[model samples]
Target: MKRFGLAAFDDQQDDKEYEGISSAVLQRQNNELKEQLAVFQERLVGFAKKHNSEIQANPEFRSKFVRMCLSIGIDPLSLFDKDKHLFNVNDFYYEICVKVIEICRKTKDMNGGVLSFDELEKGYFRRLNVDMGDLEKSIDMLQSLDGGFEIFEIRGKKFLRSVPNELTGDQTKILEICSILGYSSISLLHANLNWKPFRSRAVLNEMVANGLLWIDEQADAEALYWDPSWINVLHE
Candidate 1:
């Protein structure tokens, strides 16, 4: 008895069937994702227009709006590149960028122009339920203004540095030392950085005024000027 060899034929048919099903599933998924993105974008664009003032004034709402933007790949600040009449989103984000800078400057006095990302987020969230990720995006936008607004991570903790002036040799040295020691008093700067006592006091005080350092006044103790920018990231 002769039997037809049909094993190869069956395997080939199964393989073709599997490929066809996979391709159809993927195409459906792609179309669905595209449709969802369009709907989300339209909703947000409408929100930006009707609630421009409220979005600018409300931290929580603004934070939510920002997250909405990032997920949709919409950048508010980019509106300046094209005709403003095209979309209200551009104007909305343009105002947001300005507000972020203003907020940074307003709060800089407490931290010497440098605030821990954790601390900043907490403060905003405490009062307004703001999102850190959104604030980070706003800070990123502020960098284009030549305002020295940048976010840095030290030991895994993020920091917001808000200052327009370039750091001097002494200033950079102080930052390097603080990255290790977590704090630098005037004496430390004088001893380690070879700064004179008067120079240390002068520079440290200047940094404090510029929002570059936090000042801790202690009775009968030399003032402790610490870098608020340093985050002692605790390792587990």
Candidate 2:
């Protein structure tokens, strides 16, 4: 007897092939959707860049941009759109940007010169709501990061180009007690630490040298004074 050709498939097998074709079609549709999303993202980035360039080219436009951002709580440095236009910023970011802008403006007013640490601290306090002490510490950290400033002496008085770092917790407590008790002597610092000071007067002397503390010229022969700036730095 003649056998049927293999091409003569069973009905059940035909149904399975039809289902496989349908699954393949669905996967193609999904891939097409993803491609469309990518194209949309690219278009958004292009729009953002166009607006940013427009703002940067005109100072009036930049000021307007800042105003518009402020109206909507957008910080120019914090969040950017698809094109990197800053938007939707929190209060902290806005404050930081404002302070930085003020500093830039002040530097311009000063004929492109650096502001003294005291001047900078006052600006920070007035513009950013940062305490004087906190301002000093932050400035110190910034100077350390950028290496642009240092403490100096002029005419037998001290001034800082930048404040030094705040003391550690233990150092802070010891220093605080010494300040309150009118003890600037190394012995006082040691006594405050239960007579087990880590580095001795050598460390205290180094702090003084670095402008972190001071030796009183008018107190008892052995009196020392924790720099008032240290209090500001630590508390701030």
lDDT of 1 by residue, 121-200 (tens): 56444344336655666667767867577666655767667765656767656666676766777778778777788888
Candidate 2's displacement at residue 172, Å, is 4.3
Clashing pairs in 1: 112-211, 112-212, 113-211
What TM-score does each of the candidates earn?
A: 0.43, 0.34
Superposition error at 212 for model 1 (Å): 3.3
Candidate of highest TM-score: 1
> Candidate 2 regions off by >4 Å?
1-173, 178-183, 196-199, 230-236
| Colliding residue pairs in candidate 2 | 133-232, 184-224
lDDT of 2 by residue, 82-147 (tens): 234333323234444356446645553232222345555564555434555544454444444454
- How many Å off is the CA of 49 in candidate 1? 13
